[model samples]
Every structure is written in structure tokens, then in C-alpha cells.
Target chain A: MNAPLLKIDQLSASAGGAPVLHGVSLEVNAGEVHAIMGPNGSGKSTLAHVLAGRPGYVITGGTVRFDGADLLALPAEERARAGLFLGFQYPVEIPGVSNAYLLKAALNACRRQRGEQDIDAFDFLNLVRDKMRTMHIDEALLTRGVNEGFSGGEKKRNEILQMLVMEPRLALLDETDSGLDIDALKIVGRGINSLRAAERAVVVITHYQRLLDYVVPDQVHVLARGRIVRSGDRALALELERRGYDWLLEAAPAMA
Target chain B: MKALERILADFGSPADAGPARLAAAEALSTHALPTRRDENWRYANLRALEAVRTFLPGPAPSISPALPPALPGYSRLVFIDGRLQPQHSLPDTALLGSLRRSAAGSADAGPVPFAFSGDGRFGLIARMFAPEPIALRVAGSLALELISITTAQACGSYLELDLELAAHAQLELVERHLGGAGPTGLSCVQVDLQLAEQAQSTHTRLLQGAPDALHYDTVAVTVGAGAQYLLRQVSAGAQTARSTIQVRLSGREARTQIRALATAHEAQVCDALFTVLHEAPGTRSDQLFRGIASDRAHVACSADVQVSAGAPGARVVQSLRGLIDGAGAEVDLRPRLTINTDEVQAAHGATTGRLDEDLLFYLLARGLSPVEARSLLKWAFLAEALNAIDAPALRRAAGQGAAARLADTPATELLQ
Candidate 1:
């Protein structure tokens, strides 16, 4: 339905010349949330990076179609301008570039792509003030260099803040809940939930099921050794939380 | 005559000069001009200086060139072609009074006064041929804007400046060196700074020479007990620009900071050398330099920090970063820290590369194209040193100018 916001078929990739994601396939439709739960080294982050067009990741064989266009053919910034956003697991610290500057530039790029004018300075400030409040971030952090010296939880919140401002069509959250505490997790979950709409899609790639508890996913998939072995509903996440991933890997030799 | 001989002939014989000038000339003859064999001149050749030796000094500039607007709240002292243009400066009775007289009298004013010692061949030439040496005894918080303009291509120019600060005094000085278009011949400047106990000074030098000009500058400073000193130098638009800075921390708790930014594009060559000596205990020094080389240009920086054997509790840190974009662009960066005492802390680093790929990718992910990302990262790298400028307005102006100049360089793609 609706051309499936994103469709990946037989996607095989490698990072640093080593095979990571092997023939992984998935489809995400607009107006829906999907959860990918896997153990470490299951190519969870690799899939997210590949979708965002990060360099150093070789696509051995695969196809990623975003709204009926080849996503792999675009550059990183082109992908970003085309409504594809990746919330990095470890937000990079860029010195001398303020957070506000980064967000304004990113938002203007998306706006230009959408045939809209750039936001005025005064209006931009007001908009960010509101987003900061919703994300529980300090206004002082906006003046600081991008992610420079930011705490783990603060960095995650900043990611959500950026996502909110840009409002991309497809948002990929790669382990956004990895180092966040219970309170931070709830805030991030709420920030992400507020952006969910009938015309947007989100893929939450995480190692634990706790994040899914706050922002429940409509579909849950178990990715083992770079392949999606089982696909189910919310019950699958609950079962994975109770049974862990080892059982799934042991039960199916094909997953190995 | 040889190149050095021709230069010496323009200034006449050393016998007619003052003691300092005589000593400088003798030193020049004794120690030949710097050569590639010298470790300090490893990356810079003195052939330009040799080529300009035959150019004689022009007549004193009759009319001063239109100088840039002064930084607000600063008094001006303008010099054109090595001659002081008092008509263009503010009326500082004491300052003008000293300029009317010989500077030799003021440099040797009181006990423990400051003086210049010739350290290189160019220093000697500056002393021997310097038309007018502006020497001053500063007191009671002084803010000054000094402009030195070089005109008349057929002739050369040399300047010698000596300034001493009294105890507990403060000084903020900005020096601008501008050369005429299509310039020829050599321009040499020597500045000696002597800070008394508890004195503080912030010195900024903006050096802009003609695309074909040659320049040699040397600054020697001695820091007293409980004194502080900061020097920020930005040099650009020169065919061959060489700067040497020497500092001696002679008293306890004396602190100093040095930041230098050099941009060399086209066929320009920019060289900076810093030698810091720690002679007393509990002294500290921080040095940083940033260079951008493009289009077959070259930039070189050499920093040497030496702590005496008995100078304990000394701390020193030095960092150098160079951006080399385009084919044949070269950057030679050398940072050395020699600590003779076991109780000292010293760290030095030198890095020369195009740019950080991960940082570039991070910016790209923020929706910046490749060119925009490289420009931002380049500005960020140079800002690390530009932040050392104490004046906010001046820093902002210089930063914007540098960014605009660097924005045109070709972006080196992330081939990695």
C-alpha cells in the first residue's frame, strides 16, 4: 500500500571489506513503525548506514528503493535532502560548529528540496526553542559546538530534536536508546511518537525491547547473522524480550 | 659585489653606524645568510632575499597611502616606506617626543632596559639599514594602532621597533604591514618587546604583502616575573614571507601564548619559526599554528621549546595543523619540545592532511554538499588559532576574510 515507503530486497553489504549484512530483506509502509531486534554484530547499524549512503560500506548485492527510486544512487546529503534521516548511534562531535547552525542548515536544505523558502532567523529561533522544550534540552546547548562535549543522553535528545525540526519522510533511528536512561528513553520515545503520522515512516533498530515498550512497533522482526529470520507482530518483541535472541539462533540452523 | 655586499653597500659602511648597527653588521658578515643546511631553514629558501639585494631603498614616501580604518578606541602611528608619517597619527606628546629623538637613547633608558640582539642575517640587515627605529617606554594602559606601508617598488624598506612596558602596565597593540601592488625588493622589520614585572600585553600583527613581494620579520620578547604576553600573527598575500619569533621567559610565573595563521595560495611561500626558552621555574607557554596551502603554494611552521635544566615546573604545549588541497601543494610542519628537567610537562604535535573524512561525512549528513562541508571544516580548523585573537571585532573580521579566501579552494573528495 502507498508503494511501501521503503523496500529492501536481497540486500547484501560489507563494511571495511568484511561482509556484514547478508541478503537482508524488509519492507516498511508509511503510517507504520517497524522494529529490528538483534544481537551484537547482527548488521543492525550497517543496514541503517547503508540506507543513509555512508561511505566505506560496499553493497555486494541488493536494492533499496525509497518511494520508487534507487536510494543507493544518491549521495549522503542528497539522501538527506530527499527526506531520508539517520539518527547516528554515536553522534559525532564537530568542533566550532554550533548545534543551532547545523540544524538550521539541515532544515533549510530539506525546505529547499520541498520547494519552500528558508525559515527566517527570528522564526527559526522560536521554532527551536519550542523543540528544545519538547526534547528536554537546555537552550545553552544550542550555542555549543555540534555534539561537542555533550553527554550521551543529551546527544540522543539532540538527535530527536534534529529529526523533529527536519521532519523527514523516512527516519531511521540506529540504537537511539543504547545509552539513554529510563527518563531519557521516555523523552526520546515521546519525541519520536509526536512525529509519527499517516504520511511518515520510522525504523527503530535497537538491541533491547525496552524502547519498543514506550513506542510500540506495529511489526517486529528478528535479524540474526544479517538475515531476517522471523517476522511477527508486537507479540514477537515480547517473546524476544522473554526468550532472548540465542534461542532464535539455536532453533534455526538457517539463521546461523 | 656579492648579494650581501650589495645590500651592505646600500646602507653604507658599519663604521658610520651606532653600536647596535655595527654589531649587527659584524654578525651578518660572521654568520652567513641562512641556508638549506640550517635546520630552521629546512623548508624555506633565502634565494628571494638574494635576488632583491641589488634593489636600493627608495626616497621616503612623501605622501602616506590611505590606511585601513583603525580599530575603534585605538590611537594610530603610521609609517610609509620605513619613514614615520607623524602627520597621520594621533597627538601623543610623549610618543611624538620620543620619535623626534634618536631611539638609541630610549632603548638604553634605565637599568634592566631592553635591547635587540641580532639572531639572524636579516636581523642584522634590519639594524644596519633601518631608516627610523621607533622606541617607546609605555606606561599606564596603552592601546595603539601602528600601520607600516611599503611603496615604491624599485626601492627597499627596513624598520626596527623596540618597546618596553613598565611594571604593572598594560598594552594592546595592533600592527598592520601593507605592500604596494606588483612590489619588488625586500622589507625587513625587527620588534623587541620587554615586559616588566606584572606587565601584560596583547600584540596582533596583520601582514599583507604584494603577490610578488619579499618580507622578513623578527620579534624578540622577554617576559618578566608574574608577567603575561600574547602574540597573534596572521600573514597572507605574500610571494615569500618569513617570520621568526623568539621569546625568553626569565622570571617565575611568567606566561606566554602564541598563535599564528598563514595562508599561501598560487605560488606564494609562507614560513613561520618560533623559539621559546624557559629560563625560570613555574613558567608556561602555549603555541598553535594553522596553515592553508593550495595551487602549488607552500606553508612551513617550525616550533622549538627548550626548558632549561633547572627550570622545573614548566609546562609547554604546541600544536600545528595544515590543510593541503590541490596538486603540488606542500606543507612542512615541525614541532619540537626539549625538556631537560624531569618535573616539566611538554607535549607537541604536528599534523598535515587535507581534512578529516569522518568530520566531512558528519557535516554531509547534516545536509551540506561536498564543497560546503569542506569549506566549513576548513574554517573550523583555522578558527582554532583565530580564537586566540583577543579583540572580538578584529577576530570576526579576520575570520570572515579567511573563510572567503578559503572557500574557493577545490574540495578534496573523500577518496578513502
Candidate 2:
């Protein structure tokens, strides 16, 4: 009714001259969580990256509308300033930039874009500390380099911490739970769930439904070969877990 | 050859010439200035040397130039145009008592040992014409700050610093080179360090010459048994700057660590060469170099480590990285290791390229402007070396200096 928060229509994209997503369409409304379940090479990450305006992807034919504006027209940074966040599957390790510095800089950048003043240093520290507690991240890690030498679970937790702090309008998480253990996954889920509001949307891209156990999605979509072939509720996720992706792969072509 | 001849002619021996000074002048007269053909001098900007019309020492400025704020917990020594300004120095009498000055023909005028094998012409020139050399022998813990300021006179300046640490002594030295407004001419500096058994020394050098200045520095160090020498150097100024460092572990269990960063912008050229030799058994050495070049600038670093057959159980590690940010800029890093013994552990890596694209994208994806992202990455690259500075005050000063050179914005903003 209020024009879905994000509208992707017939989106076809290619990476390195090879087509990855072929005429896929999806819509995500505010206040709803969507789970995009797909097997390896299903172009789940590509779809998320394309929407977030990552370079090196050529949109063959498509359009992405965020909040009724042409999302595909903005650069990656502008897209970020526009309240779009993409949680990288494998977070990068920036050895010389401390975690606190990055978090503060990023938060300030976003605030400046929104015509707001920079967050006070004292307030920022308190906010970060509270979020770190929720994410189960050690306070010492804030002084260390950004994810530098962090274990797999720690990196995932850091991504979640960043997401909770940024509070984007739409969050596209690409396999953030891949390397996370059960405890860490619960923390990450809590971190993500804390950001849900009547005006925010989240798209969780994963192969398994374990993350959904903590942050349940209102809608589930099975993407195979770059196209969403099935749409259902939470039962769809359990069904996929019960029956591997082969059945979907078998039905994907016909559905297309 | 003409440049060498001109320098020799301009720098006639002082009237009180000692044997060491005379020997240095004689050495220069016999050998031509090093050219590109010399392997060690291949990357040097020799043209800067040839451009000099005269190599005469600069006269003291009529007005004292402004100096950077002094570091806490250190006594300061100020030098203007190669001449010590005693009035501006803050001397700690107990430790300053060991400080000695030797002019030509003075009793302390013995030939200073230099481990550098490259063209020793620069050191020779400094020896022949520099003002009274400052020599310090330390027997107790001390912190000293030496500031050398070159005024806006188109004349050469030279300084030689010799340091000797007694057994089990500890010393921290912060040396800074600042240039006055406009062209500061050529400045040559030679430093020799000798560490006794179990002695430790931490030396940090900052070179911030004027935009049109030419700088050449040579540092030679010998570590004795169980002694440790650490050198943290940052070069962010001068149109053509070159520093050659050589460290020799002569006694068993000696150790040395060198962390150097060179930031070159505009059309400037910055070059550094580090050679470490493990001549005794159980010696260890670690070297890290980071260079950044932008806006048609050139930066080069060459690290060479050698383990002799007699130096069994020696360990060596070298990491050299360079970043080029401009289309016309160039960065070169070379890490070389030569081991003659089977019981040596050596690891070396060298890389020169633009900033990591993924790292850049990660920053951009977080809403940082491109300029902010680039500056942050560049700061991070240099911080790897700057962070190794043990003193927090010195580290912040160095970081601010480096950040200033890499960006047009305030260093505090960029560093943050």
C-alpha cells in the first residue's frame, strides 16, 4: 500500500562479463523481514551487492527503487548515506584503523548526511559499549584494529555490532551467520532484531534457517539460479531444511 | 665529477683541520660522486646534488626560526645552521656532562667509524666541513631531544652526531630536522652509534625540510653482546631526500629493529636503504618499511639482510610495503636476504601497489566520502610503522606530521 520500501523489477546483472542474475524481481515492505534462501551460486550475494551499489557489477537490465528513488543511480557511499547497509559475508580486516575510529567516523558520516550534528564523543562511547554488550563483543576489541586478526565468529559479531549502531532503513545481510557458532549466532540475531522497527526492513540471505530461529522472517523466498521461484512464510524455510535445495533446483526452471 | 670537484673546492679544509677531517677531504678528492651505475645509489636523486652551486655551510640566521613544541620528559638541544645554540638548549647537567663537542684538530677528533658501504662522499663532506661534532657517552638512563633547523639560505649545512652507550646503559633520543620558510638549501647529516654489552638505545628521527631542500643522511650502528638498538625514522619533507642506514650485530645475541616510513608528495623524491648484517652467532634483526607516493612523487626503499657463516642461529625478518596514490606517482620496495649459514631463520616480503580496492570499498560502503576513505587508508598504511614508536607523545607527533603530508585537511581530522 505505501509503495514497498524497496522495489527490484526484472533485475538482471552480470559480474566480470558473465550474467549472474537473470531478470529477477522482488519487493520488500517496511516493518517486514524477508529471508532469501538459496544454494551456492544462486546469486544471493550478487543481488545484495548490486542493490548496495558495489562496483564491478553491470546491470544488464533492471531497476532498483529505494524509498521511491532510483537506487541504482547512486554510488555506494551515497547509497549508504541513504540508509542502505550491506553486511559483508567476509568482513575485511583493516589493520591500522581501530574499531572505535571506524565506528565513530562512519556514524558521523551518516549523521552529517542526515543534517545532524556529529555524535558527542561521550555519548558515542556509551552507545558503542551498550551495543557491544548485546553483540557479546569484548570491550578491548574496540581499541584494536578493525577486525584485525579477529576469529570468524568475532568478525561476524562485529558486522552485527556495526549494523545495530548504524540502524539502516534496509539491511541486506549476506551470509552473516556462515561462520558464527550457535551462541554467536544468537547474539548476532539479537543485534539484528534490536534494529527492527515499524519503518525499517531487513533481508537476510542465507543457506540454512538456523538464523531465522532467532530473528524470524515474515516472508521466505527461495532463489535458484538468480530468480525467486517460491514465496511462502516460515514453513518454507523449514521445508527447505527438511528437503535439500535439489527440489527447488528441479522446480526452478519450470517456475521461471 | 664536476659536482664533487665543486664541493671539494668550495669546502676547503678548516684552518684547524685534524687528521680525520683531512682524511675525509682526501677520500672525497680521490673518488667521484656516486652515479646511477652504483647499485646502492641507483634510485638516488643525484640531480639534486648536481644542482648545488656551492656546498659552503650556511650562516646563522639573523632571526631565530620557530621550533616545534618540545616533547615532555626530554632535555632539548637546538642547532641552527649546523651551529649549536646553547642559549636555546635545555641541558640536564647530570646527563649533559657526558655531552662533548669536538672541532677540527680537537682531542676527540678521531675518525668516526661508518658501516655504510655506499658512496661515503656525503659522510666525508660532513666530516670535512660540519661544525664541531656533538658526541655523547651515556652510562645512565637519559632522554634527549635534538632539533636541527635550517634557515631560508641557499647554502649547505652539515651535522655529525656520535653516541656511545656504556654497558647496561639505556638512552632515548628524539632527533628532528625542521626547515625555515623558502629554500633551505642542502643539509647533510651523519650519525654513528655504538652500543656496549647489554645496552639499549631507542632513536627516533623526523626529517621535515622545506619543499625545495635537499637532504642526505647516513646512520651507522654497531650492537654489542646482548645489546639492542631500535630506530624509528619518518621522512616527510625535502624535494630530494635520501637516507642510508647500516646496522651490524657484532657481538653474540645482539639485536636490532628498524621501522621507517617515507611519505612523498608533489614532485618530491624520497629514498631509503637499510642493510643489516649478522656477523656473530645468535644475532637477530627486524626491519619494516612503509612508503607512500602521490602527485608524481617517487618513493623507494631497499632492505638487505645478510647472515654470515659464523652467525649460526641468527634470525631476520623484513617487511617492505609501498603505496602509490596518483596516476603519475611511483613506489618501489625491495627486500633482499643473503644467508650463508644453514641455521638461520629469515623471512622477507616486499609489495608496491595502489591501495587495496576491497579495503577502499569497505570504507565507502560505510558512508565515508571518497576523500575521507582514501586519507584514512593512507594514514593506516603509514601508522603501521608509526605505531612502533614507543613514546606516545613522539608517536602522536609523528602521526600528525605524516597525516599532514598525506592530506590537505587538518591532521587531527584525518588522523581521527
Q: Top lDDT: which candidate number?
A: 2
Task: Compare the candidates by DockQ and give the number of the best one.
Answer: 2
lDDT of 1 at A173: 96
Docking class of 1: medium
Q: Model 2 misses residue B223 by how many Å?
A: 0.9
Q: How would you encode candidate 2's per-residue C-alpha lDDT over B21-96 as one tens digit per residue?
A: 7777777777667887888788889888888867888776666668777788899998887888878888788756
lDDT of 1 by residue, B315-414 (tens): 9999998999758888999998888997988888899998888888877776788887887677667766787887776776556445434536422221
The reply for model 2, stretches above 4 Å from the true place, is A254-256, B105-107, B407-416
Please, what are the lDDT tens digits per residue for candidate 1 over residues A20-76?
888989999998999998989888888998999889999999899998899999999
Query: What is the Cα-based lDDT of residue A87 in candidate 1?
Result: 93
**What TM-score does the A-chain of candidate 2 achieve?**
0.98
TM for chain B in all models? Answer: 0.91, 0.96
- Model 1 whole-model lDDT (C-alpha atoms): 0.82
Task: Estimate, for each residue in A6-56, the C-alpha lDDT of model 2 and write its tens digit.
Answer: 999999999998888988899999999999999999999999999988889
